[model samples]
Target chain A: MSEKVLMKGNEALAEAAIRCGCTHFFGYPITPQTELSEYMAKQMPKRGGLYLQAESEIAAINMVLGAASAGVRVMTSSSSPGISLKCEGISYLIGSDLPCVIVNMQRGGPGLGGIQPAQSDYFQATRALGHGDGHAIVLAPATVQEVVNTTTLAFDLADIYRTPVMILGDGALGQMMEPIDFAEVPRRQCPAKDWACTGTGMKRPHNIVNSLYIQPEDLERLVEERFERYAKIEAEEALWEEQNTEDTELVLVAYGITARIAKSAMNMAREKGLKVGLVRPITLWPFPKKPLDKLSATAKRFLCVELSMGQMVEDVRLVVNGRAPVDFFGRTGGMLMTPAELLAQIEERMGK
Target chain B: MSADLSFLHSPRITLITGHYGTGKTNVAVNLALALRLSLSPIALADLDIVNPYFRSADARQALESAGVEVILPAYANTNVDVPSLPARVASVFDRPDLHAVLDVGGDDAGATALGQYASRLEECGYRMLAVINARRPEIARPEDAVAMLRAIEQASHLKVTGLINNTHLCEETTPQTVESSFQYADQCARLSGVPLVLTTAEERIAAQLQRPDLLPIRLYTKNYLERF
Candidate 1:
């Protein structure tokens, strides 16, 4: 009952969202990520999903908050600026303890950035999605199949953790189409809706979903409780794929689109007698520090490859604890580095 | 009922059908878009209940913006495990401004749903075009092609309006095969009253065909906002 179908990463996400019970979507037009929104626009209507072409990123994020508070597996997506606007809502959802999916099909930006895919949002998504003392369950899928798999998992994690889950993808992943199995998707066992604020009626007391805790004591209590949930989520959702990391002298740490290319380059270096392997972090937030730290102890050197000016490399350095000499490779503003370029980097580092 | 001389009827509703490698859906999508210059409000519904990969509706945004109403089963409507046809499509029957193009699954038991919609299609006035790709397995001969069309018309309750020559080998297709397809289409036209309304060639390959009188074709993949 399953077969291979070639699809763009964005297309696979839409299909996966449908398969995984993502019936509500709100997004604005952003290049490199336009396909995803376009997919939703055409397919959502037919599928009976709520697809709103939000007036602005602010409106879009609020729409997501509205839907998420209703407990309808809601999601809103944008690139850099769009994601920045979404941060406040993300913090709100975290404070209010509402579950939802937030996809950052990352594009280059500090402000109104270029449409080219970039990983600059790593810290934005990983450290602080919005203004607050909070964390998000962020997943970075490297393949088209993983895009489907990770997004589906994001929905589950958001529900289970009652927090927002960020799917960190760049333009390269969004645009490239590859063969995938849209069928084997497991049915999502919806969590108890007792957490949702869908009007309690007279069933006990009137339910309320708000980030506004008027009392400082109540706000501190809510933040502390949410942090407890975040701790549990961090323990549970740290995901990374280790490709030949055990015996390798030099290990490359990467994620999302860049990670796939890194793996290919590492394998090429492996063939060329350079002992380089790839460690891909599937969840950027839980950041896979323990495993990376362990690898750091054994590995003679570490390399971090990224689309930005080596942002994740900083995380790698922090996790490495100076156990190994860390190196960095990068291309910014949507320029993709080929396997050849990465292989050269690995070879150069090995020569060092 | 009256002389509905709209673009949809000018190039009748023909279906491109076959197995996975048969190039039917590809031909169907290309053909529908190629005929777009004349503003054909083609209804390309992927009844590919067999294989959900590369569905016609994936390109719905392009067609819809071009004023072509695309039909696909409501995915978000219900939690139903299997995809069922939308009830509103029955209105395509009464509306002359519409054209109904169905891309059904392969010849196996997957195509049985066609019988249910066939009669309604007849009353609504649709011209079903059976597609043949010589390179497709089990559907090479004219007889085999006719049988596939017959099976679809029986299942879908639509008449074979004509034949479409969609002889392509994906991105590797050449102008020669498309030209030979044109000849095969003439043979099909001789037997069936439905005219061989068109043949498709990649814009590059269409340039290679170099025939001034060739029917319309879909050679380019248009982005969504470019629908007009």
Candidate 2:
């Protein structure tokens, strides 16, 4: 048995990145995520890693791109608006097929919404992180322990697929404290970065890391090849957790912090003799459609809960495909919905 | 199985400070609520500018309803993350009749907020207690804990007169966990030349410990689902 220590979600994620051999961290401070950057600043140098606070979020993400291009494990983190500033760099990372980890401790909204927890960036993370037909592997962990596990996995997935990976968290998840043991975190073997633009040393052909292709045919060919990789990830990398789904009438679908709330509500509904269950998607980008697709065959309906105004509900609706009616309940601007409120929503949704 | 809370009586002003996420805010809130029974005109000032969430101000409704005046940072409970202190924090010091419980932030960064009021606090005669959780990595060892205490002292320009052992793995805490932390807290107290005044445990775990020094408390700064 290993010693378990209490740590905030952001601190745990930062420490997990260090343990998993993330050698460089570039970030700008934001609410709910400043602790991550602050931790990196204090500990990275001690652990023989580099931590840089760039002039802006745009500069920080570009620094991540520069570091990732050199074949090092690199990461950058931000909140919602700060993440929006990194979109151009994210697109460049995808265009060049660079591997790096990006953590978004999401706060509310379309613009400078609030410094409270929110899942409003669901569409931004899943559909339009950057302007392209590219996708990043987005993992939304519901607990601090899972935050550590997924952060390590995010780096591995990035290196393995040579595509960016996103750890989607909310303010509540980032700020809360939980007990976790680092010794229990799994370590993945990453392949060598042969494509990295490390100095050739006159040994072989010089490698180049660039997103710009002058010829449209060359760019299209590259994008098509990237789509194949995305297809494989969608098939093999989607992860989800199902609880009490057997013969259940109503299945609640949620990710990130809302999933934790939904789980409690699910148990409450069951105590009241309602056939309620929960499907928590740990992977938001791949969307975890298989389990939902299978459940739609038996479940009467789906309820999507979030800290946003109906973002992930769209994904649930798409997965259910009218096999069952999809419903949504959300609280915006950093307000958290209580389990009792969710229970009431469940009772009303079931027409009880 | 009730805790002996007499140790908290004479501080006049009690400022809780410790490493980040070591249950400082929880302890401050619980202490304020507990003291309100015997003490009059209780006030809790949220001096945590380092953290943007889960501050003592978040429990304003509960604290205010219990008749504990809650003084928060200027931008607390709002969308802004500015590290502004409330002008009313001076009132906690000026009014000699008020029993003030200041919830300082985590680490030296968080303690900087307390420095500006060092002279006023000294005039009012305060006892700052550093909460220690052996499970937290930065201050797990006695030497490290003392070093953090010294750093906080330097940052806040005030001496920590006492230590509180608050070791736990959140809800996973067991009596054994609290028992095992005794030596660490004792050593920290000895090394820093400060008295080990109290050890806090959850109400259930505290009953099992059956220790006189134990202060039984219900964790208030938990997630909504944890309480539900």
Candidate 3:
């Protein structure tokens, strides 16, 4: 058995990235997510790795793009506002087919709303991570252990698909301390970065890492190819966890911290002789629709709970597609819904 | 397997300070709860302003429910970034019957907040314990540990009279990890001119060891969202 260690969620992710052979980390300091950059600043130098504190979030992500272009596992992290600043760089990375990990320790935001945990960036993360038709592989981790496992996986996924992967964590998940077994991190095989521009040394053809395509036909073909890859990802990479949904009338859909809270609510509702279960989406972008679609066959109602005002609820509604009544419950602007509050909402939605 | 914690005997005030990520808050929380078993009118003050994530004040409900008075800064549990110290901190000294525990923040920046209460802490003859975690990279060596201790002492304008070896990797800690850290702790104590008062291990690991000074503890630091 691997040793279990108590670690903060943000710090665990940074360590996991290091252990997975990430050599360069570029990031700016932001609340809730600063610990990750701080940890990297301390540990990276010791390991002969590069840890650069960029002037701004924009500068940090561009630096990540430059590092990833050299065929190394690279990463950057920030909170909601900072992530928003990196949107252009993220789009450029995806358009250029560069593989790198980006962490968003999410805080409440439309524009720096608050420095507390929030899932309000659901639309931004899933619908549009940046100003392009590109999609990022967004993995949401609920526990400190998952932060390690998912972060390690994030690097592999990014490389496997040659796309930017986002580890979407809220402030609560970043700040929380939990015991985790690091031995459980599953290692995956990543393909060699043959396309990287390592100064060819006048040997092979020059590899141009650029997203700009002058001809409309060429750009359209590139976008079409990326969409084909995304289609394959959507079909194969949607991951989720279902608890007590085998035979229940009501199913609660949530992710991240809200999912954990909803699980408690489901357990309490079950104890009260109510048929309630939980569907937690581990992959936020590849939305985990099939399992919820399967549950819609028997479940009489669906409740979408989030830390935002019905952002993920839209995805739930789209998946349910009128098969059952999908109700929405959320608390925006960094307010947390207690288990009791979630249970009350569930009970109310169930008409009990 | 209950090793004696006699080192905690009859201190009117105890200040817990250490480098960041040294598990000072966890030790302080456990000490407060343990002190409640024998002492009366115990107060656990949260003076941590550096790291916003883990603080003694986050466990206010548990400590208060266990009859431990919790003194926290204004909006300690909220997302406010202001490091405003509360007026109630002064009240901890008002009651002579109170056995107050100060969970100071980590590093010199964190310990600087303690400087405001230095006169009171000195007047009360407080016992400040420098918690050391040998696994943390910054304090992995005795020289680094001593440097950190000096930084904390200088910043807080207080002296550390004792040392507490709390060397463990979060969930990865084992008996060997604790045993191996003993030399680092001993060297640190010898160099800093402070007595190594106690060593700590998780209860499960401590049960397998026969060390007399080992204090077995259940980890109390958890996610704020986690319910009791």
Error in Å for residue A286 of model 1: 1.0
Candidates in descending lDDT order: 2, 3, 1
Task: Judging by DockQ, tell me the better candidate of 2 and 3.
Answer: 2
* Candidate 2 residue pairs in backbone clash: none
Report every candidate's CA lDDT.
0.71, 0.90, 0.87
lDDT of 1 by residue, B79-184 (tens): 1224466776566666677665667665533456666766665555555556666544235456666666666666665566656666665444667767666665
Chain B TM-score list for all models: 0.73, 0.95, 0.94
Most accurate candidate by lDDT: 2
Query: Which docking band does candidate 1 fall into?
Result: incorrect
**Candidate 3 segments exceeding 4 Å error:** B1-12, B21-23, B29-43, B61-70, B87-99, B115-124, B132-151, B154-157, B165-193, B199-228
C-alpha positional error of residue A92 in candidate 3 after TM-score superposition, expressed in Å: 1.4
Write model 3 residue lDDT over A1-352, tens digit each, in one string: 2645567788889989999999999999988898899889989999989999999999999999999999999999999999999999999999999999999999887886887889998899898888878999999988888899999999999999999999999998998766666788899899988899998888999888999999999999999999999999999999998889888899999888888888888888999999998898999989999989998889999999999989888888888899999999999887888889998988888889
Per-residue lDDT over A1-352 for candidate 1, one digit per residue giving the tens place of the 0 to 100 score: 2635556677778778877788999999775676678778867888889899988888888888888888898887777778888778788887777888888888766777666678988988888888878888889988777888888888998888888888989876786555566666654565687867678776867567898877999889888987787788678768888878768899898888787778778778888778787788888888888778788778989989888887888889998988889999898865678888888888888883
Return the TM-scores of chain A for each candidate in numbered order.
0.96, 0.99, 0.99
lDDT of 2: 0.90
**Model 3 lDDT tens row, B143-191:** 9999999999999999998898998876667789898888889999999
Model 1 misplaced regions, further than 4 Å:
A187-190, B1-228
**Runs in model 2 with CA error above 4 Å?**
B1-4, B226-228
Per-residue lDDT of candidate 2, residues B186-220 (tens digit):
89989999999888988988888867777888866
